[model samples]
Target: MFNGKFLTPCFKSKQPWKRLLSTQPSVVLAMSGGVDSSVSAALLKQQGYKVQGVYMRNWDSLDEVGHCTSKADWEDVQKVCSILDIECSQVDFVKEYWNNVFEKTLTDYAQGVTPNPDIGCNSFIKFGSLLDKIPEGTWFATGHYCRTNNGKLLRGLERNKDQSYYLSTVPEAALRRTLFPLGEIESKVKVKQLATDFGLLDIAKKKESMGICFVGQKRKFASFLQEYIDQPPGPVIDLDSGKVIGQHEGLYGYTIGQASRICHGSHKWFVADKLLDQNKLVCVAGSNHPALFSDTLVAKNWTWIHHQIPTLPVQVDAQVRYRQSPEKAILSQTPDGQYALRFTHPIRAIARGQQVVVWDQDWCLGGGVIDAVL
Candidate 1:
């Protein structure tokens, strides 16, 4: 199904899939009905591991247009499992997801801070509740584009599609039992090719999902959030002019570095900050305004994958958001015992409540939540 032009680079860089021998023989894979997971199941079966697929039903409601997205995905899972000769089942985690991930996300937004729900889902749902519900001693596997080396989290071979950032919050114990079959695959193009070879042409051509799973592609994020969170309107003020430019429906609708849609003027206005006490949305005139950048940030709830904190003032590559290149920074502990990251150069749009994942070359050291921007 891949174009010839796209397959050339993938073929050149493709490496032999290393066959792993498992002492436990049985594996439980989290199948999301995506090409990545489908390929992972095939690879696991090829390795002689008895595979069982479990589809997590995290969101129970229909999409904005009254379409049941989860139902369609489950149907795909059944088709893939039938081809692979593996048993498949579904688990209901809707209540757990609401309490652990969604509730905390709404709370962060209501407080005028940006939060990453996908990070929370990985930490709390996939690695937390799912692990607890599964039978003990059964090795767990997923389609995550990451690797675990001797209980240490490692970046996948595909640098552009590496997903170690989302799994930074997962505990070390969880990593020890996890298997990532797609970790060594050179590119997503190769994954799709492998899926087609495994007789999963429909899944191989399926579009890659983005953003939060609960918020469907057809839905407006702000409108979906407003249905659950009750927020009042606030004033939108120009940062440079110090004048009220317009009114915002709610502070939750805007995030730092996002373009302000309500404020129309000669210059495009970007959200610079949120004045929570005064309930004001500060907007800067230009996209590259100095107010949008910060050289340092304070993060709390620090978690190391190996459960061992690093020495102070250590230099490493860090990223404030997913898909962003990791930048050089020094991570040190403050005198008051809080952890802080000081970038070698200024970083842009370091938002509060978002995560800061650090890496030491190919190894993911782990990360923390951005509590304050300095």
Candidate 2:
């Protein structure tokens, strides 16, 4: 039920990866009871490598209402560990999750930003805390559809499976020790076939995760942080007329370029920007105007994978959301000491504070938090 078709915006992925097993990589597999990691562990084992499957004790509260908790994923990991016949362990990242990923995400939301938690999860927990448990020579691995070239980050296998965009912020040190076994393999369909070939359970048949991994679907965002997040009601202003159209429950609850959940939908509205100073939602009714969207965007917090940043601004493509194509753009350094990227074609709803990943061909140059639009 969870894997049923839902609203998927455009995402960028690699064409498929080829991982040679010559190294006999000793890896720590991050298992989520899903197909991707299941197959990754299976492949590592088939190649005669030492593999360990570890289920993350995520930050979701044990007392959280509804389907968000430890029981389901825990049981699934246990079952998968038995099937894979690999060493399995559990690690509690609740404290680190709250401090590093959760707070940073909610804080960005409060500032009228849509921060990607996967970025934080990779940089902090999965690669940070989970990797710490493995031995010195062992590499950390995941179920993600991404790849690396000579320890440098690249697009993963399956053009539809690329996840490098979410990892723009991952440090180079981590990339050196990271492995994506599923990066070059076929889709989950083939992964399922391989599972059957190996006498393993049907991991792909299990429902895919929707929304936040720890937070189950349709649960109010506020409930996750009753102690930390505060929802502040604000006015929804008309962008063209500059008049108030409706009242929003909280400025922090919405993201730039969102179309759903508008209080007043009699007239179509798109979030142009978040007016945090005024605590208002600045929205446009009909967005036929080119000026409303962006062709060039500047992202802060820039980091490159395995390569020094170019002194000259590089020509590349970028994506504002997951599953989106990397739009053609030119990169430049602004006077403010941050990077600026002007796209070949203007992209719709280029929200400030959302993620912007830049790619030079299949090689990942880097990405940053969007700070301005033009």
Candidate 3:
């Protein structure tokens, strides 16, 4: 159970549950057996909406032992649905996820670019594949920490837990039907308490999922990557002194800004860049190295949630990665239709292939894939 911190629930009116039983719309919730999605189902039930819970099995045994963790998750989903007295269903999206998400992820790393599979999974699997599979006329919901106002995507009330960045590239039409029951909750701790209050003690205490999508908690991602791609040892070069300082297992094993894995002494080194053509890994001494900072970046495959690109040179808050605060920047499209972002101050370790999500106050303006750091 979450540490006790009381906050008023989203529905302030008395007997909100009564209305849902009468005429409220029915919704199909994508339950992942996590606390956030659990609370979503409880809230929908509380609001009197006829709810059906669907757990997506996106990864199977072929992914690696204990990688999927679907068994435990499905058990939780069943428990939650039973408590709520709702029907639960499971779908196998293993083929779709492998082709659309997992394959592209390996391809990105092999090319020396770090990609965000979570972002792609939200677009292609959760919203794309699942939505297509659900029966027609069924409204959808998920545990995503984002808001939709008038068919537009908005940042969740909780700044730290806002998941708008991942959902930024999802189809606008998907946003139109999807509901985030936890959108207005300001804290994850509060969500846990809400679950506890609703008698979902197990889910309230469930640990958060991290690293690559579908991978079990505490699994080493670098080791997992090796299963698919060869990590050939290569020289780690110093960007400033232009000398070979150490050797890396492979360029694929490291990411920009990652602590230098080859360093063995008091001096610390960090990944600054990669030379894919020459098969070299570039490292710079110290965390404050100028080589790690960039004020400009080029992002391709721009996806604007509103389905319209913003005018040139508009100022907004740009987030290069999840959990990082959005920095002030000017966003504009390149002549070739890709987008560029120039931060008011230099940002550090802007990795290629990561998403650069933008926002105008509370509204998520959508984002594009980072093509280069200039």
Candidate 4:
């Protein structure tokens, strides 16, 4: 199944993989049949590492229209591995994903909180169960756009695509054993170009995957979630006037800072908060409503990359969401033992259950879940 022409581009000195030494470490790369992971396998193989591709099936349920991409994705993985001449395998993690990530995510959503399943999947599945399934001495690798140095997670060189935030919850032990081949690449454009040069043009042209895998792009999130969550409709109230302006399918359908689709008025309305106890969806009149921003928030269950909490009241750059510009903030411990992140300037939509990743410049110190927005 090997293509001699496909292997030629990987050896070019100008390729980003050229920086890697010929260490030949045994590596198990998480291949997702996307351009990123496919390129990761190629880079690892080119670096002289003994690489094996493993496709993880995390979600098994079919979409509302009775469709799933797992089969197609596996086909792509096989094609990519064939071109690279590497042994490829598949593993099912559906049970583990449900127990560790999806279950907790649904629970959070049911309570009007927005939990980030990607962070949980990285910590529990990708670096957790997947690591256990691999050979004992094999180094784990993935297509994540983040860097590591001396066991510390760092931002990807491509700032816009930096995924250090999503990986903040991963343990230091996992960080040490993980390899990120795409970390040093200048941009996603370069990655696609590299894929084409590597003779995997079909995979290179694939659209980037987004959102939760189980929720497939074809279905509405609310509709997909309705199947799993018994979301009773609730009132969408205006924060300023305290008026019941519209009705919402459920609190899970809205997140802090999102525009209120159900509300209609001369001015656009944004979700300001969710009064979970009262089962209310609060809205503000304008997109830039003062109620939509907050300067302080509390984050609990903090995961420090070094496994040690830093000095209290430490100043760091923090991000409440992925791809957001980092903001200057102070992280200090609260009386309740939770960490409080106070931004120098007000940040918009600091939602509960969302991750707040902190960075010491480019080094990802770690992160925690948003417990309270103040």
Where's the lowest-lDDT run of ten residues in candidate 4?
Answer: 1-10
**TM-scores for every predicted model:** 0.92, 0.87, 0.91, 0.92
Model 3 Cα lDDT, one tens digit per residue, 1-374:
11111121112323211223335676888898989999999999898788877787777663455456687788888888888777676777888899999999999999999999998888998898877765555578999898998778999998899999989898788888889998999999899999999999988888887755555555667777887898688888988888888888777778999897776457799999999888899988898899899999999998888866577889999999997988999998789889999999999989999999999998998899999899
Q: Give the top-scoring candidate (lDDT).
A: 1
User: What alpha-carbon RMSD in Å does predicted model 1 have with respect to the real structure?
Assistant: 8.3
Model 2 scores a TM of 0.87
Please write out the lDDT profile of model 1 over residues 237-352, one tens digit for every residue.
98888899999988898899988886567888999999988999999988899999999999999898986667778999999999799999999988877789999999988999
Clashing pairs in 4: none
CA-lDDT, candidates in order: 0.85, 0.72, 0.83, 0.85
Q: Give per-model CA RMSD.
A: 8.3, 8.3, 7.3, 6.2
Count of clashes in candidate 4: 0
The reply for model 1, stretches above 4 Å from the true place, is: 1-24, 66-68
Better of 2 and 3 by lDDT: 3
lDDT of 4 by residue, 218-289 (tens): 767777778788878889898888889999887888888988886477878899988878889999888888
Q: Candidate 3 local accuracy as lDDT? A: 0.83
List model 2 lDDT by residue over 1-374, tens digit each: 01111111111201111122456666777888777788788888887777766677765554356666365776777677677666665656778888998879878877777788888888788877766655666777887888877757888867777888877777778888888888887576787787677666556577677667556655766566444667677788887788888887777776667663565657777777777888888887655544367787778887776666766677787888877977887888888878888888888888777788877788787778888877
TM-score of 3: 0.91
